[model samples]
Target: MLTRISSVDHLEVKQVVFSSVLQLGDSCILNGFSRALAVQRETEIFYGDEGNFPSYRIFKKPLPLPPITESISFLRHNINPIIKVNNIDVTAVSNSSILHVGNSQTVSMEVRVKHIRQLLLEGHEQDI
Candidate 1:
């Protein structure tokens, strides 16, 4: 069992128990079972290394869900977060927007089989 405060939404995390949810909270969780798409802004430069690099200005717009693969990464800015979960390792590459929690936030979560194995092995089945 593990716990910590998430900087994303200031939610208390109990653990990383599944692929859908990167972290678990009392009310909701951060999910990563799907690929998140973001809007991009392109620009043209006339000077500097712009000639050597790709001649396009790429700015990934902030998204509701940060783009993450393998581990947690590309979290949007404004969402100051600290992920705390046991046996979970996340790597973030870019920063952009905030993941908001409003009145419409859902509470249901899907637990992963791997998380279940870890909990039972550690004798914390009650947590499930």
Candidate 2:
């Protein structure tokens, strides 16, 4: 496989987090795993959300079957030996994600999110 780019004018990436990858060229393999625990409360009170919490701790355990363990075989035929791009004006890539401009053999990505939202009304003081 071949990749060619004449011009890349601008590329803006605001944020990338939690085992993320941003590739501009060819790659054999790309693997990413992200786990997050989010808590949102209406009031200013904090619930002490931390890694020690049971929900957050669950991600620490190993996966049942990881992608790397599996055997993979593939054959690629490159009829066109060259890939030409005249111009790339603007690009934005964000978050546990991949942006590849060229050929890729294998790409694997996994994301797990647990979000908890709590609302406290003005007249619900007794509920607490």
The clash numbers for all candidates, in the given order, read 9, 0
- How many angstroms is residue 127 displaced in model 2 relative to the true structure, after the best TM-score fit? 10
Off by over 4 Å in 2: 1-18, 53-79, 89-91, 125-128
Candidate 1 structure quality by residue, lDDT tens digits, 48-124? 43222232222223234655467655745545344533343344312221223322144332221111111133454
Give the winner by TM-score.
Answer: 2
| lDDT of each residue in 13-117, candidate 2, tens digit only | 655555666667677788876667677776667656454445564666665764567688998786756555555443444446776666788777777777778
Which pairs, if any, clash in model 1? 7-80, 7-81, 7-82, 8-81, 43-57, 76-96, 76-97, 77-96, 77-97
Candidate 1 runs further than 4 Å off = 1-85, 96-128
Query: Which numbered prediction scores highest in lDDT against the true structure?
Result: 2
How high is each candidate's TM-score? 0.16, 0.59
Candidate 2: clashing pairs of residues: none
Question: Ten consecutive residues with minimal summed lDDT in candidate 1?
Answer: 110-119
